[model samples]
Target: MKDEKIVGSFQLMKSLNKSLILNTIRTHGSISRSDIAKETKLTPPTVTNIVNELLEEGLVKEWQTGSSSGGRKPILLKINSSNFYVFGIDISPREIRFAITDLNAQTLLYKTITMKEEMTSSRLFQMIAKQLYIMMDEACIELKKFVGIGIGIHGRIDADEGSSGFAPQLQHRNVPLKKELEKEFRLPVKIENDVRAMAIGENWFGSGVGISNLVCIKISHGVGAGFILNKKLFHGTNGLAGEIGHMFIESSGLKCSCGNDGCLEALVGSEGIKQRTLNKISLGYKTKLIERTNGMIENVNGQLIYEAALEGDLLAKDILEETGRYLGIAIMNIIHLFNPERIIIGGGLAKAKNFILTPIQEVVEQRALTEQAKKTEIVLSKLGDQATVIGAVALVLNEMFSVQYESVS
Candidate 1:
């Protein structure tokens, strides 16, 4: 039950034939050995060998018999989803969330730690390690049961290095997340941008399931996007492919954290929405928001505006509608550029979907080039607040199920 022994056993399961057979069983829910061999194009003996190894390792199990073609029924195999576990971490500007999930990405234990203030990289690392230890002890799961650790963090990420290039909210640079965590836990570690992780998570377990090309937009204190192109997470050169928040939308609009004017995030991100509401208030346009925030303009925020809009407050509704229009413009541009099958919106602002979704649809309808493009699906995230954290878990599951070595013909 030593950590190395566990790691070694997991590593042994990474053979190309093993991954192919395992994924086949996972995908089919339960599949016969002959069917797996046919589906994976592996020889019957190869499939039998790997499946037997998987069963012995407890990664998969033989289920009830499947219908046969006149002969005896064949025993089917399926993933032993609960046999191994993964750790997922979601790091945002204001908080860090931790989750333990089975192989299916179903959360088992979850916890959150709020940040009163920003801390150094070392401090952040210590907090994460301590909390993970507490969670492991609390869950009482054996150390050998853990397969890997995954982290989804904001800002630029050097995934190959498993380090953060710059976490703007945390004000930390070059934080060695993968290196530190793998050293501390003696388990494999994966890291990705928070938004990209959400996209992957959605593709695997949420709304984007079965969609080949998709985009997931997170609109909170800041805006960001994750892109899935051709059924794969597309990380552009320098891993900045989905930084749509900084995408230029207007030259004369408000400033963004990236120190740019009129970026998509500046127009519709939570701060931008709040600032626009405050600007409207400053212009002598009156509404219940003044009293709702107790005449303290600084207390005004996206959620309060949404609540006010729900109550038929014209000013609040108008602000959200305009914000939606801004988001729609950005999404339309995304459609023109990537032409994804669907775009999923998540985060704090998505709660105002009632108000914003209409405007967004309207803008796309009015401006998109082709009729098909105009009808592109735009929906809110099914995973909601847990999207990023679940995506963190997907980072590990993805690795676990993927065929690492290319198969020889």
Candidate 2:
């Protein structure tokens, strides 16, 4: 028991040290061993030994030497961002988006394969595997350097088992996604809620990199949030913590995809925006949208509405204002609950930046609790469409490095 405890302690310490050294190199771009030791507060010998191990593993490479003050130039070390690759797949309703990313979560190659709406999860996963292999072949990335596969799916997932629990958009139940993929590819698999995976990505490499507490709210066909609390992805009990889309917004509103009445998604999602515009058209409201969509109500979508708004159409702007107001209510609730330092808005709706952001901020400033509202900064996501896919890559890297979750300041 004494020997076992000592061994475990040693292993933990070694892992922590390795993470520190690698992270230092990653953040500094190229750093000397002495600088790494100073940044990580590890001894020079410890840094050298760990860096040597990383060098042997091909995770780190020696770059050009740094000039010394009065002695021999010191060799600089950097993370070989290209040495290893992680494959990420985003499984949405009508498409499977695949990306091969380097260690830094930068996309090396990206491809999307559209799928039939009626396909089964098994069939989808099979296609996913095929597309990944094709991408790997095209990129000339060997399987040996592939870290693992990270999958982001639309609905609630049993992240531990890599199985779906409830995926209304997917129309699948209890699919053993991780098991099937792992079996087929013979590589480890990590599955996460698509938005949560995006949050993880932001935490690692995007806008939330240094920011500790933030929420990435996605508004598209559905509404959801991925939280980075205290610099770690917060998967609440059952991994459903961030389903803000389903939050009760209206007691008697439209039925959501989740079968909930008056959910946030039902009010502000892509379909919801279209429906609201149609409602206005039905009420005989005059707008340029009639000309914009050629008098076809069915043609009015979120993008058209934003375009109309940008063209100075009052009705379209009003609809967006209403959408932003609803989103603001939800964000106020988010502020009251999480009190995050930053709230990142993404998804299809986020494209209408000023149209949505201004109203949401207006409502938040007026309605949210004074203290929380004052502390929070609402912003749009920088990752854009690549958020979830790159986030999936981040999942693999975080796992391999065993990222240390630091407390938010």
Candidate 3:
């Protein structure tokens, strides 16, 4: 009976504390103890207890007193913005994206370091560490003030073991990334698939804000999808849910690096698109893309193709449309299977929204089931390239809040 009583009281405390903290400022805006009690249905004593704890934890701050209501003025309480920061990194093949963010995940500083030449997992990790150190130093932020560190990678992840289970791009499998980073910096580290991180971040701060069911498809050097189902990041069994890139979109077509043929990535990835376009133009294809690119057909990406289309380059425009149509085919399948409420397009290639989105939208509008299609809204990701890094930070915050609950309750 004694143990049960203690457990019941602890459970009550958890529910009440979370509600009071979230509701206090929510109802009254900038509220004080007296107002919080009046608005929350919580006793003045209980409100007082929780507010004091929040103040000490730097979660809330007391501002100046409000105007007198012909009685003793109440002290104003506001959410503290600078209490702690979540550091995030997106370790992409082309670049290293990093950000310093406050408690609410608002970025304070953003920086990118390029990987001009070769990229090895070990070397890239060190580069990331170096860039993070520089970012912290430049921002004059002490390591202690950082809530946590999060790194988003492109490929499968073993979330439980905190390792990169198998990343063809990174050429590392089951690498103990989180543990090694945590040991090096003395900070808790979270590692996740880049698309998964983006989905979480988008749900928290971008296109999926307030939406529970959505998909964020990133089209870059590679293509990937991140899903949010039942208001949570859904990584299926064995952490291999969002490998949309490797799925067979072409039965016996272009070979993918994953020992597969006709993966969606092979048909639309930057390298693939560039190779195909360069080959066509070099063979005397008549398109404004060549002249715009100064006739240099070394390597073209979706962005360049989009630029040409926007500039009325006929071949470039057609290429983008074709890719978008293929995307439509793949995304149509995604819609049919998962039936998401929203489809958010993002990535380096999404910058070519003018060229890619319209064709994809057209196909979806034409082919999808009328009822499901009507329910789903397709749009561009507001965070764009920053989505990956911001999502990484969201991973850290999720871990931080969960740990806080563990400690408090």
TM-score of each: 0.92, 0.88, 0.81
Tens digit per residue, CA lDDT, model 3, 71-146:
7666788867587787899877567789999867888999988878645455766777787888889899887777
Candidate 1 lDDT, 188-210, residue by residue in tens: 87787788889989988998988
Off by over 4 Å in 1: 1-9, 66-70, 156-175, 404-409
For candidate 2, give the lDDT of residue 246: 81
Lowest lDDT 10-residue stretch of candidate 2: 1-10
Q: State the local distance difference test value for candidate 2.
A: 0.79
Per-residue lDDT tens digits of candidate 2, residues 46-123? 998988888987888998764668777778998888888889988777677899998888789998888766355577
Superposed Cα deviation of residue 6, candidate 3 (Å): 28
What RMSD does model 3 have?
Answer: 6.4
